[model samples]
Target: MRTNALSTLSFWNTPRIGVARMQSDMAQANQEIVTGRYADVGLALGSRTGLAVGLRQKSAELAALRDSNNAASLRLGTSQAVLKQIQDGADATLTALTGVPEDKRAGVLKDMAANRLGTLTALLNTSAGGQYVFGGTRTAAAPMSTYATSPASPAKTAVDAAFRAAFGLSQDSAGVSAITEGDMAAFLDGPAFQGLFAEASWGTTWSAAGTAPLTNQISLSETVETSASANAPALRKLAMAYVMASELGSANLSAAAQGVLTTRVAGLLGEASKGLITLQADLGRSQAAIAAANTRLESQASLLDAQIMDMEGVDRAEAKTRVDRLSTQVQISYALTAQLRQLSLVNYL
Candidate 1:
C-alpha cells in the first residue's frame, strides 16, 4: 500500500468538486422552477414518458379540431345570413307581383327582378378566407356567371334560344301581344323551356359549383356539411323566375298573358323561398353540432392536460425551496474558496 500526504492542491480540489456539484443542482432546480416541468422529462417520468407524449398529442389534435370548427362556423353562418336575404327578396317580389296593376306589373317587376338577380349573383359568389362559400367543393372561383350580355353569357344565350324555339319570335318582338295566356302557360310548362332551369342545364351554363357541398369533421365521430351549392334547386328556380321577368317580353304581352307569367313566377319564387328556409335550418343544425362538438373537445383536452400534468409537472413551491437552499450553499462555497485562496503561512504567523 502506498501512502500519499495531503497537500494544498488536495485541499483546493475537494471544495472545487463540492461547489461544482452544488452549482449543477442549482441549475436543475432553477430550470424546474421556471418551466414548471422536469428539466429532463424522459428521465423524470422514465417508463411513463410515452403516456405523457400520447396525451400531449391528443391535446394537439383537439386544438386542431377546434380550429376547423371555427372555420366551418364562419362559412355556415355567412351562408345562412345570405340565404335569408335571398328568401326575403323572393317573398317581397311575390308581394310586388300581385299588388301591381297589370299595365305596370311587367316594367316594375322587370326592373326589380333585374336588380334582385344582380344582387343574387353577387351574393352567390360570396367568399370567406379567400374561398368561395357557395361554390360547394369548388372553392377556387366564383360560382355564378354574370348575367351580362356584352360577353354573351351561356345562360343568357340559352334563354334566348329557348324563347325563340317556343314562339318563332324574339322575346322583345312587338308580335309578343299575339301570345295568349294559354300559349304562355303552355310555353312555361313545356319541357324545352323548363329544361333551362333543370339541374343539368344550370350546371352547364349558370354555375361553376360542384354538386357535392363541402364538409368538415368537427370530432372523431361527427362530420357535417359546411357549404351550400349555388346549383341547389332553390337557387336555380330563383334565378329562372328572375330571368323570366327580366329577360322575357313580359312588358309587351297582353294583360291576361302577363297575369299568367306573374302567377307562374310567383309560384316558382314561393318554392324557392321554402327551399331557402330549409337550407338555413340545415345549416343551423350543423352550427349546433359544431358548438356541441367544441364543448366535448374542450372537456377532453382538460382531462388530457390534467393527466399529463400529473405525470410531468413540477411542484413550484418545492423547486423554489430547493433552489434557495442550493443558492445559499453555492454562496458559502464561493466564500470558502476565496478564504482558501487568501491563506498563507505569513497570515498564520
Candidate 2:
C-alpha cells in the first residue's frame, strides 16, 4: 500500500505548530505575570514614599505655624504688661492729685517720680528675644539715657539740655514742661505708641522735656519733672499741685482753683485709664486672630497630608494577594509549557 505522506506530514506539522504556539503564548503569559508582580511592588514603594514625604511636609508646616503663634502671643503679652504699667502710673498720679495735703505733696511728687521713672525704664528697655521692644528700629540702644547733675541738685540740666536739643523744647526751673496728662494719654494712643507694640519704627524724636523735636515724635521717659523748670504737662500739673499743697499745708486752696485742678487731673487720669483698657482689648483681639490663623494653617496642612496619603499609601493586603495570584499563574504557565515541549507525534500514534 502507498504511504499517506501528506496525512503524516499534516499530523506532525499541525500538532508541532500548535505546541510551539502554546509555548510562545505561555512564555508571554509568564512574562506578563512577572511584569504585573513587579508593577505592584513598584506602586507600593511609590505609595509609601509619597506618604512619608507628605507627613514630613505637614510636620514642617505645623512647626512654622506654631512658631508664628508663639511670636504673636509674646508680643501681645508684652503690650499688656506695658499697658498695665502705664495704668498704674496714671493711677498714682491721680491719687497724688486728689485731696493730698501740701506738706505731704513732696512725698507724693517723689513717689510719682519713682513711678514715672520705673515705667519709662520699663517701656524704653522693653525686650523680646534679646531685641528691644520700644527702641523702634534702633533696638540696640536704650530709649532713655542716663542723666545726672553735679552737687546732687534736684535739677536735671543735662537731661533738660538733651531733651531741648533732641525735641526742641525749653525747660522750667524743675526741668519740667507744659505737657498735660491728657496729651500724654493721646500720645500713647497715637501711631508711635502702636509702633512700639508692633516692633515698627517711630516717626520722630522726643525729649525728657516732653517736647517733640520733630513734627511727629514718639518716646517715653520716667523723669516727667525735676527741680529744674521744663514744661512737661504731666510734670507741670503735678508740680503746681504740690506747690499749692505745700504753701497751703493744713490750709485749703481757693475752692475755685481746687475745683478746676481737681477736675483737670481727674479728667486726664480717666482718659489715660480708658486708653489702657482699649489697648488691652486690642491686644487680646490680636492674640485671638493669630491663634485662629495658626489653627487654620494646621488644619490645612493635615488635610493636605490626608490627601497625599490617599494618593500614595499602599494597600499591603491587596498587594500580597496580587503577588500570590501572579506566582500561581507563572507556575501554571511553566508547567504547561514544559508538558507541551515533551509531547511527540510517535507517542500520539
Candidate 3:
C-alpha cells in the first residue's frame, strides 16, 4: 500500500508532459500543411535521406549548368550581332568602291576604307560585360594590335615590314606601282602574306583559343566552341583591304595600278563575303550545341525535382488531415491539463 501512493505533483507533471507532446505534434503538422513539406525531413525519410541528398546535389548542378548556359547564350548573341554589323559594313564599302568609276576608285572613295578600318578594328576589339569578345581565352586584353606602329600593337610593326617587302614600298612611302594582278596574287598567296595575317606571328594573342577556337563548358560532361576564333578571316581580309586603299590612295596610281589593286582586292572582298556565310553557320552550330545542353539539363532537373519531392515533400491533403487531427487532440489535451490543474482538496470544501 505504501508503494502505490502517487503525489499530486507527479500526477500534474505526467499530464503536463502529454500536453507538451501534443502541442509539438500540432505545430509540426501545421507547419507541414503550410509548407507542403515535412517538418522533420530527416526523420520522415530516415533511411532515404541519402536519396534526397543526391537529388538535391543534382538539382544544384543543373542550376549551375543553367547559369552557364545563360551566360554563353548572351555572349554568343552579342558576338553574332556584331559580326553581322561588320559583314554589312564590308558589303557597303565594297559596293561604294565598285559603284564609282575606275578613275576615281582609289583616291575618290578612300574615306570609306578609312572609316571601315576604324569600325572593323573596333569590332575586333569588341567587349561584352568587361570581357573582350574577340580575345578568345585571353579576354582581358585586345586580341589584335591597333593599326598604328605604336607600342599598343606589335602586329602593325610586322605588317608594315611585310608591306614593304611585298610592294617594295613602305606603308607610308607615297610610291605608286604597276604592281600587277599576278604580282599581288603571288605575294598575297605566299608565306610572307601568311606571316603577316597569321595570328601566330602576332607574338601575343588575347584569345584563350589561340591557334584554336574558344571552348565553353555548358554542362558537366560536355563543351562547345563558343564564339568564332577571335578575329575572323573576313575581318582580316577587310583589314588588308582597308590598309591597301588608304596606302595606295595616298600615292600616285596608274590605270594598270588601279586595275591590279582593285581586281585583287575585289576578289579578296568577294571571297571574304562568301566565307562569312559559312562562318555564320558554324557559329550557329555552337549555339545549337549550347541549346542542346540546356535542354538536357532541364530534363535532368525535372527528374531530380520529382525524386526530391518524393523524399522531402508532403502530400497537401494528407498534411491538412493530420493538422486537423492534431489540432483536436491538442485541444483535448489542453482541457485535460486544465481539469488536472483544477483538482484540489480545497475544491471539495
Candidate 4:
C-alpha cells in the first residue's frame, strides 16, 4: 500500500552559471588577442600605444628638419674649403711677387693669374651633388664667365664683351682704381669687404666687375676717398708692386725701384700667409659644425624608428597563445553546460 511519490524535479542548472562565466572569460581573452592589448580599449594602460604614436610622429618631424639643417651645413663647409684654397693661392702669389728674381717675375705672374682664374671658376661653379652651391638659386648659369687664356687676343676680347653685356657694364667703366694703404686696411677690415668675403650679394649682383680683367676688379667702393698728399696705403702698395713687377719684366724701371719692389712683395707675402692661418681656422670650425649636425640627425632618426616600433609592433606568439586559450575555454564551457543539463533524477534511478 506504500506508493513511491516522485516529485517533479527541476533540471540541475548550475552549469548555466558556469557556462556564462566561461563565455565572459573567453570573450575577454578574445578581445585581448584581437586588440593586442592587456587592458580595456579606453583604459589608462591602453593609452600607451597612442602616446607612443604621437611621440613617433613628432620625432619624425624633427628628423626632417635636422636633415635640412645638415644639408645647409654641408654646403657651408664646402664653401669654406673653397675659400681657404683661394686664400692659399693668394698667399703664394704674394710670395712670388716679393722674392722672385726680375728675370722670373713674368712667369710667376702668369702662374699666379692662372691660379686666380681657377679659384674664381671654382667659386662660381661650386657644386654639391651636381647642383650649384653659390649660384644663389640660379643653378643653370655659370657664376663667372669663361676665362680667356690670352688677355690680349680676339677670343679674350669677345669673352670680355659677352661678360660685360650679361652684367650691364661698359668696357671702360669696369675698372678697379689703385687702393691706398688706409683704403686697403679699410677694405680688409670694413663691412663692405667683410660682406663680400661672407659671400653676400650687393643687391642683385654676385660680383662687382663685368667683362673686365682680374686686375681691374677693385673690391672697394667709390664712396671711399684718400688724401691727395698721402699715398693710399693698400691700393698704392698693390699698384706699386704690380707696376714694379711689370716694369722690371719690361726692363723699364731703375735697379733701385726693382730692389724695393722685391722687398715689398716679400712683406705682402708674409702678411698673406698669416691671413691664411686665420682662414683655415674658420674653415675647420665650419666643418666641425656640419659633422655635428649630421650626427644629430642620424641619432634622431634612430630614436624615431624605435618610438614607431613601440607604438604598432606586435608580439605574434603571445597573440596566438591567447587566441588558442580562448577557443579551448569556450569549448570547455559548452561541454560542461551540456553535461549539467543532462543530469536528472530519473536518469540516476
The best candidate in terms of TM-score: 1
| Root-mean-square deviation of every model | 2.7, 15.7, 3.9, 14.3
**What is the total number of backbone clashes in candidate 4?**
11
lDDT of model 3, residue 330: 71
Displacement of residue 327 (Cα, Å) in model 4 is 14
lDDT of 1: 0.89
Query: Worst lDDT window (10 residues) for model 4?
Result: 222-231
Off by over 4 Å in 1: 1-28, 336-349
Error of 4 at 194 (Å): 15
lDDT of 3 by residue, 19-116 (tens): 67877887888888788788998898999888788878889988988997887787788788877887788788788778888777877556777777
Please provide, for model 4 over 1-349, each residue's C-alpha lDDT reduced to its tens digit, 9 standing for 90 to 100.
8997643332335545665776676676666556654434335336575776576677766665565555555555565566566556656677566466764555466445555554545564666655454444443444443333444433234333442443344323422122233433443344542332232332122232222111110111111110010011221233223322332222232344334445555554455456545544644554565455556657767887675555554465675676687667767767866776666677989
lDDT (10s digit) by residue, model 2, range 1-349: 8875455445445545555565554554454355433233344556466565656676676666566456546645765676577667667776766657744444354445444644544464566656444443454545443222255222233333433553255433222234443543443344433332221211122223222211101011111110111122332333223322222111132333333334544565666567656656755666566666666666767787676546544455565565566556656656665665556787878
- By TM-score: ranked, best first: 1, 3, 4, 2
TM-score for candidate 1, please give it.
Answer: 0.89
What's model 2's overall lDDT?
0.45
**Colliding residue pairs in candidate 1:** none
Residue 117, model 3: lDDT of 72
- Candidate 3's C-alpha runs over 4 A off are 3-16, 148-152, 161-194, 203-209, 217-222, 331-349
Q: List the residue pairs that clash in candidate 3.
A: 135-207, 136-207, 136-208, 137-207, 137-208, 138-207, 138-208
Error of 3 at 182 (Å): 8.1
lDDT per model, in order?
0.89, 0.45, 0.72, 0.46
